[model samples]
Target: MATTNVALQPKRGRPSLARASAIDRVILERARDMFFADGFDAVAMEQVAAAVGISKGTLYARHASKEALFTAVTLDMIAQHSTEAARFDHLLTDDIEQRLRHHARMMVNSLVQPDVRSFQRALSTVQHRFPDLAASISEVGYRYMVRIMRDDIIAAAARDDIPVRDAEGVALMIVSAIGGYQLYETSTGKLTHEELQAHAERTIDIAMAARSSW
Candidate 1:
């Protein structure tokens, strides 16, 4: 009888767990780029698999569907933005007004980034399909800013640096005002660096003025 050649046989089922996890990351990254570059409806699973140099079967094994992959991508993006926002803590100062100004400018600068805008556009494009995701995203983003502002306000009040009756309400108001300004900028036109700086300062000034009434 001829000797069997085991090595020549086809190699596999799924990859090793470690390898599979790595491939999953690559797939998500490539899928994210595609989704950002070409809108959700325009990107197909086949396109993503091709971009990752994987077979459609393999891609589907990792992510059951295109919507599932997009969900993963959205969560990844949110985690990344959260990490970046966390770094802003180091930029804060002992001066409450200056701290608020820094936060305003940093937040606006982050929103103006091309990749961030692309992600926002992606979300808006698919809002109807992912209403709950959209709501969660909005809540998380809004809550983070409000938390930071509220903490700063409470700290300042503790030190008698400012007079505020309701820290939480004040925080909400400030965040909303800045959010409105951001919306205006997005709808009208991009602001220059100087203009953004001025905008940040003006927002801080209004907040400072209103603290007495808060």
Candidate 2:
């Protein structure tokens, strides 16, 4: 048998895997920026490819179409937002009221993020054409927030921080309040830091006042 030079053969290694991941991340981040800046219907894949200095073939190899690209971008945003939310470990403190206020403030803070506001602004524009996509985006956002709120509320109740009546229902209400504020602020216009903070504080304040009576 002919000698096989296996020792000299080039092997696929971790470098290629790292390079692939880096490329994917660059594509997603650049595409996400374009998608957020311009509505999904408005952005072209070719434009994203150009922006990222990649050929259409390379872009297509990563994402089939604009809609597919949008899905990837949206999923990445969701995951990132969850990661950001998870880092707020201070909210699990013994001070129940402070925790609730901090959560609301954090929600408000996210609402003002360039990515979050941009994504919400595109909802009305893209929803008619891609109803399912729009709905999925909204549903995923709501469910994530609700789950976080529910957990926090339960924790607060367990610590006797807040009255433990209907924790799930209260959590949903809190999420609705925050979500509603976010929607309004994004669609209407920019809310100054002062204004955003005031709204967040007031929202939690009112909700807490109600819980006191319940």
Candidate 3:
């Protein structure tokens, strides 16, 4: 019989590590909410930790600095969006108009989230101060938006309902249309949220209709 020397078993702390990471994520999300509402310059790391019912030392252990935390928060926001978008992607139907409508509704839902709206405003305020933060936001948020839209268009083409000539280009055009509508609301005047949703649906419908020549 081979002498199985089960020498001093190393401590297995994987569960503890996982639990700690989960706590850190919760802290980061709470901190992100406070920072967005109060502005990054006004918020402190201690305050963030306190908001999450954690100690500043614990927060620091997870995130080396305020800047790092801020960056992580932005990345988290993008991750949340991607998760939401994936849900919509799975709900895609054979009806092109219905799919467009669903997408429009989901977009409105995302924009109307209090935290998301605050995050966008906060980003606009400090993007100039931290270039890396701004770049990360751009790559995660903006770039992800473009890629998701493009992929959705491709899927629509495969479904054979939406006659898209060039799925990628058409996706960009759809994005541009939706973006223009959003800009009008943000800049010009107070458009009812319902009106914005309706406008987005119609705009998307018209754009998809243009691909009749598929």
TM-score of decoy 1: 0.78
Candidate 1: misplaced stretches above 4 Å?
Answer: 1-18, 61-64, 161-163
- Model 3 segments beyond 4 Å from truth? 1-15, 53-55, 95-97, 155-166, 187-189, 212-214
Question: Which model, 1 or 2, shows the larger lDDT?
Answer: 1
Tens digit of per-residue lDDT, candidate 2, span 63-139: 88787788889888887876787688654676657777777776776776777777876666777788778777767
TM-score of each model, paired residue for residue: 0.78, 0.78, 0.74
lDDT of 1 by residue, 1-214 (tens): 1222233222478466666666777777788888898899999998887777678997898788887888888777777777776777777778878877767776776666677667877878898897777777776677777888889888988786656789888778777776766667766667555665677678778878877787
List the global CA lDDT of all models: 0.75, 0.73, 0.70
What pairs collide in candidate 1? Answer: 165-214
List, in order, the clash count of every candidate structure: 1, 0, 0
Question: Quick one: ranking by TM-score, best first?
Answer: 1, 2, 3
- Poorest 10 consecutive residues by lDDT, candidate 2: 1-10
- Tens-digit lDDT string for candidate 3 (1-214): 1121122122354336656666766766677767877898898888877666656786798899988999998888778876876775777776766766676676666665657667867777888989998988877765555576677667867876545667667666666676667755765546567877887788777876776753
TM-score of 3: 0.74
